[model samples]
Target: MLNRFKSVVSNVMGGLPAIPHQTEIPEDPNSLQVKFHYNRPDFLFLTSDEVELTADHISRPILVPRCVNKLPWKAGYAEVINAGKSKSNEDQATAMHFHIMAHMTETLLNKTDNQVEMTDMANTGGEFDNSLEYTYFAIFDGHAGTGAALMASNTLHKHIQERLLEVKDLLLCSNEDKMNDILKKRNMSANVNLPTKRITKDSLVKGALETAFCDMDEQIARERTTFRIKGGCTALVALFFGAKLYVANAGDCRAVIYRGEEIIPMSTDFTPVSERKRIAYLGYLQPELLHNEFTHLEFQKRVHRRDIGKKILCRDALMDGWFYKTVEEQDLKYPLIYGEGKRTRVLATIGVTRGFGDHDLKVHSSDIHIKPFLSPVPEVQVYDMTSCEHTEDDILVMGSDGLWDVMTNQDTGRIVREDLRKFSQNEDSRYTSAAQELVSKARGHLHPKGRGWRMENDRPSSGDDITAFIIPLSQLNSPSCSINTQNGHIPEKLENG
Candidate 1:
């Protein structure tokens, strides 16, 4: 059994308001210590304040000044277990593989504003190859607060699982023998009314996935209605099944795969401008004329007032509010007073271009020609399946931009590699124990009082929610080519265009 021990030593200072006095300090130390009895667990410490005391540095513990104020602190861990072990003992050689250990942690940073940071993990057991098993890992980066990131991280594993199951069902249905066997076993009539014949399992699964995203978009729209905040999140997912790896992403969240000492990016960032071109090509551009009124009538009036006839500005009209105002004012009083017309400014509201929500901006041509703002439709990308070769070990790191902000890619990879080496020298070591040590090292390097830990805004570091999971490929049991054989050879190159 793996256990975690957390000790919080908070010291209270009570003395003259402005005077420095030496008092008997409480036996409780101000620093937190996490010691493991069975395994060498990793330590992650987040503090609010730091102070200098007696030539030594100490974290100034957070104080709750108001009775109604709530101080935020949250952390938890999960343990993954074998799925089949809990169900039956039918087959010992069935390759009953699953994540045996999983955990997550969340901490509230600000109470009034509800600011928080969270990290979690998802593991879908190794494939049943009876040969070799591999693990899949992913990390989510969320902005505009932690809710979106939390939701994405918690739901992503299930989404991929369902997708894989759909794929399996499709393959099963494709085999005519399997379908006939099912009919015979269930004693179902051949002419019985079955759902649409045109509906294949593959098409239904793809449609289901698409519909799930659409429904999520609707929920996001409804949530945005209550708040005026503008921002969205990004997600990066990495899958490892057998010797093949696949990655998919939308928005800016990234996934980096490590093959030996080098790092490879598996996804692309989707920006607003890229999505705009698609929307425009879809015949969604602002109408040239509302019924019969010229869309650029106001613009033309401005040109005439400036005595520059038929001259196209060529600038992005969507962003230049001045140009829109010049046009609208010119349209209001066109031709009559070219030089001496009183100038008036009409402000138009423009929406964002790309994001998960903001349906209001997705209005079609019939809607009034409110100045064009950007939209937030995310660009989704998938990586081609590729086989990674490693001599001794391989490390995979998945994190939000928060970790990137504090440590470079090389630095993160090196730290994980060094920690792995330490465990290698000790034969009686646990991977999870080493993982915790790696996290501790990262926290130490970025802690306030630690050698390089910077102090900013009374928090440990300006780091965002940092979450990572590492896998040692060499130590894992190699399953036979069961997945490839059962699933019918996965393609070597499956890149998204």
Candidate 2:
């Protein structure tokens, strides 16, 4: 069956060979030798000066690690633990938290055919402001192809920072009357207005965030490049602002905060169609679409007929026939093509109701009839620096979906908590290495039965790409600062407070 589908795909591409699947290897072999440590009250840091000094470093494939022993699967299982006080008098008691998130790719290809762009800058003294300190982390999850994802991850941060600085004059106005006048003229709301009077170090943070995402979307369109993939990526960024943590998210890649054995999710999943209320708002009849067999059949038949140009509905023109041919050749029973014969009505093609970069698939709200099918606007979530409850002992875990696939939130929390406890109580314990160890452990846990073993289907489950960073709270003594210089590099500092 898979071969038949592959043949159809090859024929469609004019006999061009299908792209081969690629998998991630373990950490880069050329990666420098780095160590994580706490500097002062305002900062926690990881440095690789030695690793950077090491010449002739070789690149390594990022692959999953195989397990030496086997373990059973436990459905929805999670474990949490709390570490006691450390022997060291200077260190404060901190809490830990974690969570797991997973989503199936739209394509059936076993391998993770994606690309990632990651940049981490620390302890840099620059002209912007020597007094301020900061750190920046971003994860871009792309689909269809990795080009857009790579572009967005590499450039979004810098683009946003530049825009905020360009608008600094407008953001720094002190007079309320004048500010109000300018905002009203620009149609900016006074309620959520930027703090112009103070113009402190933290003032530009919010403005920079808003402009970054808004501008990046527009900039990509202007480039006139066909490399922009059809699907879009979800991004989650963490900016350590002064002593506080600021989180901004668009899409599902998540930022989770751990406060001493608890899991706090900092981002919301933007699934508009998944929500019943949103579905109803689009005028979709709930009962008619609620797992009803007849309704499903009717929708499939309608869509199939529309494909052949037999039926002309108000929304028929918007249907992209590319999906029709793909589905037919695969012999897949899509939602639009169900039932044996003579009875089918197309409801919808894709399952995800909201996403970016599918502007062509959108239906105008004024159309009234087909408005329900149009994609929802992207959602933006912001976590203020003041909102998070921070302590000297807290730890922050930022990761992609790969880590969450084989582990639970509770499992991660427990492992970190226990490791920290061991390190604190035993002077010889190397608990500081937990971050790198966790990644290796996760890779090993993937296939205790055997390498590439898929428990459900009895086939080799292609390993996922995993990237993560773990920071212990006590090491967070530096003032957190990030600058998205226009040059496409986001430099950050983890300074001692």
Candidate 3:
């Protein structure tokens, strides 16, 4: 079957060689060392041979965790490699608990000496205060390479932990009367004197998430000087802290809440077309960035050399509607943003406007860097899980663009919900089964005659690497969900799974 699958793909492309992805190893073997080897997320619990099976483009098996205990809430996760798009799956995902150690802040306040240092929880032989725990789920969709995605999947949570720890007091304070007292202690510990500003719990978490993305991106940039971290990737993260669910997005990856039959969008897709105004405005502000090879103006049609000075329908960075503008020599240059819908490209190079680590990506045959135009800051949206009632059927679905490329949010919700109906709510594998069904629908089956992969309806299936997570929101409030941790990265045995 696998051989036949490969033969079909070969014939479909007319025997053309697969194009090299951005994450491919450089021809020069002596470049700086790549920081890490490509691997599936540890939570997946795949054996070495099973990991190898994931890279088989022809088989394109939808990989899922072998054990229900692998994820919190027995969350369902499924991923598949693209059909000969890259040498390996460029997408990466992580599911873990980030513990904001309560002892650090508690020790500082109780100790008489201001110079007293906090000891590590492991060294102290103390248990973690599970109340301050936060659940983190993220998906990184690599474009040029998997390095950025791999790097993010491994360390992005640490950056978030650092930021969250800074405001741990505010996050834990439930009494409104003690809010100012908490702020006073926070100011005293830092040895700083500044007027207090109104701070909300959700805002603190959101700010932490936003800054964490920036820190993660900065780390990738700084480390790349000594390490070979190829390509860039879009990030979509869903963080569950206290009663709130925060979704931070910095690229085309998406997150949605499926409550009952309703599909609530939690993040936006920052594509070139969706972010046209922002991209074009930057081009207008810094024309030098274009290298005179592109223009910020948008035209109804490409302005030809012969049509210079002719009237054309156009719009500028400030206007939304097209106006009649006289074409000029500059207008003949390529538009800063090109194509439409999923085909949109910035400076005719990248499709995404926000992500991490594309520092060296330049325009084809030009010195113009695309990094300046790309942003690592994520737009965070919050959903209060405590505000409403939820059931086992309610879930948070997060996926890379590969899944969304071929499925709508409603379609995804319906597939997951319908598949989940086959099993009892207590059966955690039900979620995994739902995730598998979601991935399978997006991935589809090989087309008849091996021409190409296609869906049941005969539409082309998603050829990009697809990943999905179905997290039951009903388990959010369960006490057994916390990850006992001495340090952030090390996962202790869960009290409950």
Arrange candidates by TM-score, descending: 3, 2, 1
Clash count, candidate 1: 26
In terms of TM-score, the best-performing candidate is 3
User: What local lDDT does model 1 show for residue 383?
Assistant: 33
TM-score of each: 0.43, 0.48, 0.86
Whole-model lDDT per candidate: 0.33, 0.37, 0.79
lDDT of 3 by residue, 1-497 (tens): 22322332233234343222233234664577876778887766555676777788887878777666657788998888998988899999988754446655543323221112223333445566533677888999997778899888877877887788887766777654576677777788998787777667778889999999999999998888777788899999999988789999999999999999788999998988888899899999999998887889999986777888789999999788999999888787777887656766676666789999988787654577888999999999999898789999999999999999999988998899899999997986999889988999898888769868898899999999999999999988674342322222322221111
Candidate 3, 98: how far from true, in Å?
3.1
Model 1, C-alpha of 71: deviation from truth (Å): 29
- Local accuracy of candidate 2 as per-residue lDDT tens digits, 196-253: 4333334456656656775665654454233333334456666654455666665544
State which candidate, 2 or 3, has the greater TM-score. 3
